[model samples]
Target chain A: MAKVVIEALVARFPGDVYDPYEGAGGDDCAFVQKSKIVEVCRFLKTDPAMAFNMAPYITAVDYLGAEPRFEVVYNLLSTAHNHRIRLRVKVPEADLELESVTTVWRGANWFERYCLDMYGISFRNHPDPRRLFMYDEFVGHPLRKDYPLRGRQPLVPEREVKDIFRGPGPVGRD
Target chain B: MAIEEKGLGERDTGAAPRSAGERPFEGQHRPETYDGPLDAPLGGKQMVVNLGPSHPAMHGVTRAVVALEGETIKEMKLDIGFLHRGFEKSCENVTWGQCFPYTDRLNYVSSIMNNVGFALAVEKLCKLDVPLRSKYLRVATAELHRICDHLTLVAAMGLELGAMTVFLYGVEARDLIYDRLTEICGARLTSNYVRVGGVSRDAPDEWVEKTLQTLDRVTELRDTIDALLTRNRIFMDRTRGTGVMSREDALDFGFTGPCLRASGEPYDVRKSAPYLVYDRIDFDIPVGAHGDNFDRYLMRMEEMRQCDRIVRQCFQQMEPGPIVVEDLRYVLPPKPLVYGTIEGVMAHFKLVMEGIKVPAGEVYSYTEAANGELGFYLVSDGGGRPYKLGLRAPGWPMVAALPHMTKGALLADLVPTYDSINMIGGEVEQ
Candidate 1:
């Protein structure tokens, strides 16, 4: 099933794509270069035969000891074709960045933001590039392999609450 | 001046500006200074209100910073993650068998479905085919959880819109279902009944009869709710045309389950990708046209009936057999055998000591949860614990689309809109 999609992907951008690799449970996965991810994803989504419309999620896996330290994964589902394919982009530890697909799929906004928040892999063209699940003051990406499981950092001092109602008769009156 | 004249004079004065450092009369009030376009239509800036991190209308710990132009919401930003417990990180740390309990907390409303989804993912990775009886039982449990989930969602939506009777009726039916579920699995909300290979135990004695009785009660309650809210002018007025998400936008937002179905798309995982015994069952996928709050409400109500049909069919067709799979590597031996036989004791010891070893692979398994598609993407390096587990929460995308849905809607419309989406905090944050 994935071979057909891979063939189409290869037909369009022959040199930019790699042969489909067997993912877990025999699911087909095709790896593309980090630089060409956005263009490839745009083609995959817009191509007539492969209408991979639904961008279910975008997540990252930290292969701590592997050659490429991180693999950013995008799970795409084609509601029209009823077929699913996973796209993986490998990023080296030193250069932890990839082009964002938010322009292709608006739903990828939060998913990309979450990937940035968890794995500390920056999406180059992401719109709202801020920490999603953690505060801005949080020190490190918690999902990284080097991060300790129970590591805790000191929190910034709590902000003092200002009294909104200063002009008053009795303070508690309605 | 006389009291009546004083009141008239005060009304005439009307927000009069006070002199600097001059104290006004005790009963007089002053308005805040506004610094904006002097020729603005409303003569002031748009009011920015924090709808919640603590507001009642917000079903969970979510904050929507709404910019209001009078009563209408001009723009809104949703801030979630208050309930984030690092569930994925936690899953990576736990063993395969140990992760089952944590799955229950993912979608706590339909927790059994989460367990089923996680189990299916692990089972797929291990290449373990669950037994026929276990499959049927899983379908039955999942459908029951769906009923509970939809009922709670609709009931809560009704309550938020000031319809108390519907809430009571819906919750009452859910309580009966939960009672029966407690009989099957000891827990009510988080029923950790599904194991990796199969269910933990078979149906208790009289389980079939009890389930039938509960189904009857649920049918009656659903009918009551329908009659009360289906055509109720107030209910329709509040929900109809509010929070309308077009089909294209809904698909683009990656909506699934009832919310997506409400947008007139007949995409159901049970039908599209038939997992378990859903392929064999005869049930209809209820869909709606407008994809508004009312349509979502109607979609859930109709889906509940379809769940009842699925549950009835499963109960009738379910053959009496061993619920748990016979794979000793994954399943524990019976208590009697463990106590009596040396082989059983050794098997139990080995099973408990070394959890089922999953192959080096990855799989994405999703179930049609009450709110939407609850997917679990699991990556294993042939170890006891997962290398990485990504939980694709259905509500996360729906919550992301909230600002889109409520942009031009009124402040009162936000409550029903939020409730209609049925965003569970546990599921969203995870």
Candidate 2:
């Protein structure tokens, strides 16, 4: 299933997709150029043989030290074909943006917003690009590799209560 | 939904009177007729009502900024994340094994499913296959959790819709199942019963017979509730046509599980991509034609029956064996082995101090979670902890489609619609 799709993809869009091959996990994977992501997704969704209709999950993994610092992964599924394709788009730290694929699949709406809120990788033309999980007052992307796990950024001022349980945080409580 | 560009406060431009015997709207298709919003706007002005993060009847912390033209919802904007505790960020800092408890909290109603889903993902990364007995046990427990989840949905649906007896029946059935679950996992709400390679424990003696009795009672109660609400005049009137979605629109919105199935799509992860012992089971996926709240309710009710069948088959087909895999690296050694041999002691010490070292790769594993498709995309870097864990929550798409579903529908219909979506805040927000 993956080989057929990959071969067709490479034949159609010669310069856009990179490293088109089945991943070690048996999923058809391709690292597409960031700029042509929407085009690729639209083509995949509309293509008869590889009708990847649903963009079920989309996430960005922060490779903090790598040259292209972030990898935005799109897990696409075609209920018609019963096959899945994972598309990864590399984004540099300098340009933390990618064109939105909302036009192709409406389901990518919140996933893109979640990516923006959690990883700080903004979608260029998302209709409602507000933070999906975190508050507007949130300081930084919480899911980034550099974001300290113990970092406490509260929405409200803390109040002094009795000693709870001892655990890891900015201020230890016992 | 090509809705009018008019503000909620703006007067209704649609003056066409409604035709009798006309059908309720479907999909995101905005109705053209100016149906009176609760007997035509009270003062000819649209009212904006905020349904809450704190209000009763809301299954979880979710806020919908609804613009009401009378009682008809003109537009809606959802403000969520009140229950968000950074599930992804928290799990990334913990060991792969520690993440089980975290996943358990994702869908607290049927937490075993979340645990199983995450465990399957990790097992995929490790390329480890669990024992046949373990697979059967996983299927049995997961099916029981499915019954519990559907029971919760039906109970809440009935309670919110003014059928209090149905809620009581639903809860009664659920309590029996939870008691059976507690006997096995030692926890009620969050059962962290799954490990990387297999399940954490085996079933207690006579547990199968007791569970069968519980399931019989549950089926009885479910039948009563079904009779009470499925065809009842009030329940049918409210849910039969309200919250309808077109087949194409549902797919476009990335709906999975019952919602997608209720939308006339016969796509079920269990049937399409069988995992665990699902391929061995013979069951049917209930498909709805109307794609409305009633269909979704019926879908869950029928699925509970199917779950009963799956669990019974599991108990009958399963044979006693080691629950976890024999892999010393992934599974902890038995108590006797740890105290008897130096090799076992070393393996136990290493396994406890340092978690299972999964090969560095990524895998997207999905399961037929109660609400929809609960997917876990795990990225490993050959470390004790996971590189990234992205949750594709089943209820997220349904919640996102609230505005679209309620457009031009009556205010009273929103309750059943919301209830039918079965949005568990833990998973959706996380």
What would you estimate as the lDDT of candidate 2? 0.86
A1-174 per-residue lDDT for model 1 (tens digits): 666887788777876878677776667788888889999999988888888888888889999999989988888888888888888888998998888898888888888889888999999878789877887788888898888987579979875433323322454455
lDDT of each: 0.83, 0.86
- Interface Cα RMSD of candidate 1: 3.1
Clashing pairs in 1: none
Misplaced by over 4 Å in model 2 are A154-174, B1-43
Candidate 2 residue-wise lDDT, B1-430, digit = tens: 1112323354323211112354443323334556776644235556667688787767887888777766788888999999998899888888888899999899999999999899988887787889999899889998899999999999999999899999999999998999999999999888999998889889999999999999889988988887687656677677877898889889999999999999988999998889998999889898987688988988998899899999999998999998998989998899899999998999888877877787898889998999989898888899888888999999999999888998888888889999999999999998
User: What does the lDDT read for residue A70 in candidate 2?
Assistant: 96
Q: Measured with DockQ on alpha carbons, how good is candidate 1?
A: 0.44
User: lDDT by residue for model 2 over A91-130, one digit each (tens)?
Assistant: 9999998999999989889999998998899988799999
State, as a TM-score between 0 and 1, how close model 1 is to the true structure: 0.90
